[model samples]
Target: MAENKTQATGASVDEFLAAVEDSVRHRDGLRLLALMREITGKEPEMWGPTIVGFGRYHYKYESGREGDAAAVGFSPRKASLSLYGLMYGPEAAELLPRLGKHKTGAGCLYVNRLEDVDQAVLAELIKAGYRHVTTALHSP
Candidate 1:
């Protein structure tokens, strides 16, 4: 199988955040760093060039495709903050209603601005994603 392009890197998370050109997004990135760190009890790391991820989990499919991925992560993209892992969890639909303004794809949650969402609910959403992946891995 082809390698995952978005592999975890030894890149500096702080340096990456500082390099973000959008001042608002930069600030939001810092907040998310702290929030995810607290929620996962893991320091943030650069996943590829842009994603700031906390913790990791390995996944294997029936086809024998397997890889490690961040348990939860986000990217402060130019258009919006892209949250990963949220929609992968079953609890997402419940927490999303409380997340305030946001858009959702199959595995991502996009928010135009941090202020447009409830920070507390966002934290809970991240926690749910982490738990879902971690617990699923442990279950039969």
Candidate 2:
């Protein structure tokens, strides 16, 4: 099996956020850091190079592939913020419509700007996702 490339790293979250060239993305990254920290009650860690993740989960598939992943995470990409683990399960299906402007790709939720979405809804999504991944999908 191919190993997961995006393993947890010892990278500095603060340094990474500070190095974000775009002023808007830098600010949004900080807000996301605070929001995710408050929601998960877990300090953020760098997953690979770009993703700022909270908590952790281990997953194993029927096909025998297994790996550890962040319970929830986001990357402040140049074009948009790529939110991971927030678009899974029924809660996400329900809350997405009310989350204001956003786009979805695979398991990711993409928002161009924080002002474009309802932060309350985003918080709900993060809470739900964090709960689902940690409790439901996490391997024993």
Candidate 3:
């Protein structure tokens, strides 16, 4: 089986966020960093190069593929903020409509800016998704 490429790294999350060239992305990245920290109560770690991850979970599939992944994470990409683990569980389906302007792809939620969405709704999504992944989907 192919190993997961995005593994945890010892890189500094603050340094990475500071290096983001776009002012809006930089600001939003900082905001997300703080918000995720408060929500997960877990210190942030760099997952590979770009993703800022909070907490972790291990998974093994029926095919015997297994790996560890962030319980929830986000990447402040140039195009948009790629939010991971926030689109899982039944709560996602119910909350997504109320999350304000955004787009979803595969397992990620993309938001152009933090101002484009309701922060409270985003917080709820993060909390619910974190709970679902850590408790229901994978053991943390």
TM-score of each predicted structure versus truth? 0.94, 0.97, 0.97
Q: For residues 41-118, could you state the per-residue lDDT of candidate 2 as single tens digits?
A: 999999999999999999988999999999999999999999998977569989999999999988899999999999
Of candidates 3 and 1, the better by TM-score: 3
Q: Write the per-residue lDDT of candidate 1 for residues 1-140, one digit (tens) a residue.
A: 97878888999998999999999999999898988899989898889999998888888889888888888999999999999987777888888998999998867899999999998888889888989887876422
On a 0 to 1 TM-score scale, where does candidate 3 land against the true structure? Answer: 0.97
Ten contiguous residues minimizing lDDT sum, candidate 3? 131-140
Q: How big is the positional error of residue 36 in model 2, measured in Å on the Cα after superposition?
A: 0.2
> lDDT tens digits, residues 22-120, model 3?
999999999999999999999999999999999898889999999999999999999999999998867999999999999999999999999999999
Predict model 3's lDDT versus the native.
0.94
| CA lDDT scores, all candidates in order | 0.88, 0.93, 0.94
Best of the two (1, 2) by TM-score? 2
Off by over 4 Å in 2: none
